[model samples]
Target: MIDIVYILNQIDGVLYFPILIIVMAVAGLYFTLKTRGVQIRLFVESLRILFEPSGDESSVSSLQAMLVSTASRVGTGNIIGVSTAICLGGPGAVFWMWLMCIIGASSAFIESTLAQIFKRMDNDGNFYGGPAYYIEQGLKKPKIAALFCICLIATYALGFNLLCSYNLQSTFMDYSFYNPATTPMIIGAILAIITGYCLLGGGKRIIKVTNTIVPLMGVSYVIVSLIVILVNYYNIPAMFALIFQNAFDFQSIFAGFAGSCIVYGIKRGLFSNEAGVGSAPNASASATVSHPAKQGLVQTLSVYIDTLLLCTATALMCLSTGVARNAAVSGAPYVQSAIGSVFGTAGPIFITVAMVLFAFTTLLGNLYYVDNALIYLNRKNKPSKRFMNIFYVAAAFIVFIGAIIPMDAAWAMADITMGLMTLINLPACVSLGRIAVDCLKDYEKQKKEGKDPIFDATDIDIDTKMLDTWY
Candidate 1:
């Protein structure tokens, strides 16, 4: 497993060092300009739509879909991942992470808006679309779409959920409440059962669970962070100063942590908000909206919530408590120590409970992508619900097994696969982004006229047939 992880990391270095970095950065910059800075311009309006109800009862609400994606985005990455970033890269990583999310929001807008524009009806009479659907249908590249979906499955299904389960198991086992030996299996089974409950109940059931759990977890985390921040209010300015000053310390002054800061921070940031990784669009596409850009804006807001709100909270907790200064910071321990500084033993327990809530919901959310991916992968023979049930059970079992064992190798593999998916999706977004641009223009035109914007497929010159709902 260690050998495999080593190999995967090597692969990741080759792919990302020059290629993925340039594409992701340049495309993010391109779209931010191409779209007239929609994320910034529409920030207020986007928030309003976020709280607004899903207009059609038949389709998932925009907020529910956003939460589903947020469920995945705001996971252990925000907590343990932040700890690792700071430990490895120094406080400056937080600044780079924030930068990634800000620019990546534009990338998210392009993919999600395209997903909405190209969404089609499944045989089950449910809405489904994503990077694969849009790449094949909108970009007219079936072979690339097929390749992309396979990587998506590898990244999310075979890799991420399993890692989430393993980490969840470890988080539970770390505490006094659960016996270390038996706790992992017990937690894994419990996760499987709960996940099966959502999966068997179908998409709406998944939506219901995410809509309920994700917000509660997010709000609770924010409240906890606020308490911690206020407790250490005097340290706030200096902590931020460390962040900004070290952010560009590419010299001997920062010593060992110089270049590492940017690398880890950007890596963790990409892992956290996942704005351009193409997963958010899967959730965004499920929404039934008058205009495709509505969901795009909602997803863009997710980037801000994930990084600016959640990740920053985690960083603040670590930095303010001085826990981040540890030379070998890793995983839940760093966060637990930070919380412990302010709240004592309650910190670890709070984090343990939060991990279960955040990671388990993420497990469910990752499954949603595979569920939609299965639909795109199996167009000829529409999957019966029974088949999907079997698939879900297998998925749960895989997570269970991964949880019961070590998952570091699988985690590394997932990083590589997820990176590939992002690279593939970014190019597609760059190409098909014009559709989103057109949709944005149409939506803005309607808004300026004092009208509730509604999307017409023809407005973007996309075949109405590709967008089954728009007619």
Candidate 2:
């Protein structure tokens, strides 16, 4: 297992770079053009959904759905992840991060919209869909799509689920910043019990918890970052210069201008937000909205919030501090030290808190996604609920194991898995791209003509019966 993990890490480290850039750049450009710049058109409308009450009883409020994703999206990767990028890639990495978000927004919109288009109704009539559903429905390859779905469920539930608990426990124990011990059993037990209780209640319980955590953590992170930026206001121009200079000026730096910056920036950016990757679609598919395009719009806004808003703040904070560029510290410790330089011992403490909250939410969100995938795999109107519960409990144990082992290794494993999933999903999206656009255009026309933009399952261009069916 160790050797395999090491091998996977090496492959992931090399393969993921160019792939990230191509996907983000292409998907961003494609979606932007396809939707006729819906990102701009719905910019205000996206914000409006947050303020307005949800009328749909079956789907979560758009805000709640976003929060479910943000729960995972805003994790330690935003802070420590950003710090690591700038440290290795140089300050210029921030530019690529921002660039991806700008383009990745459209990619987010398209995939999520597709998820909505093929969303399945559970026995309870609740909406459930994601890569698996869309893959089966959109691609007409149930066996291939089922493989991806199982991979997703296994990756999340058996792999990352317990890894999160491990991260949380290690983070809390190491908050002292000196001595830390493995407490996997303790951590696993707590998470397992809590997750079991929540999973039994279904998606709403998971979303409810995520809704509360995501906003609180997001606001706090922003506030902390704002303080760091304000204190080092004078460094702002220099930081900006570093980012642009590194992004394109590779010949100028030790790492070369575009070389490391472009590589690491895109790598970290994709890791942080997962915009073009298919994971976000899982969360987006469940959103109850009158139009598939509405859910797409909502999820698109999330890409902005994750990378542009939350991630950019973390990057700026590290660059502004100057410590991130130092050769000495490295990785999460470097980020903690940078924050400490500004806020003293309290900075690390604050970061640990942020990481705990972010990672915790993300863990829950990912688990929720995996659970849905399992349902798709089982296909029967009535899945064996008990098996799903057992699988999640085991996942929590794995999360605990991942926490103390090594953050970088776990991240690498995650990157590899994520890349594989995206490879399958991106092509699927492009093949079904016209259908997504058609759905969007149809929805828009309906709204303009003073009609509700509801889609009958029968109207889906994709053949539902041809795809994988559980029952």
Top candidate (TM-score): 1
| TM-score of each candidate structure, all chains considered together | 0.89, 0.86
Task: Please identify model 2 stretches exceeding 4 Å from their true place.
Answer: 1-6, 49-52, 57-59, 158-177, 180-214, 252-259, 324-328, 380-386, 446-471
Candidate 1 similarity to native, TM-score: 0.89
lDDT of 1 by residue, 260-299 (tens): 7776787778878887899988888888777899999999
Please report, in order, the local distance difference test score of every candidate based on alpha carbons.
0.80, 0.71
lDDT of 2 by residue, 196-311 (tens): 56656655766576667667878988988889989999999998887787777746544443347677777778777877677878877667776677788788778788888888
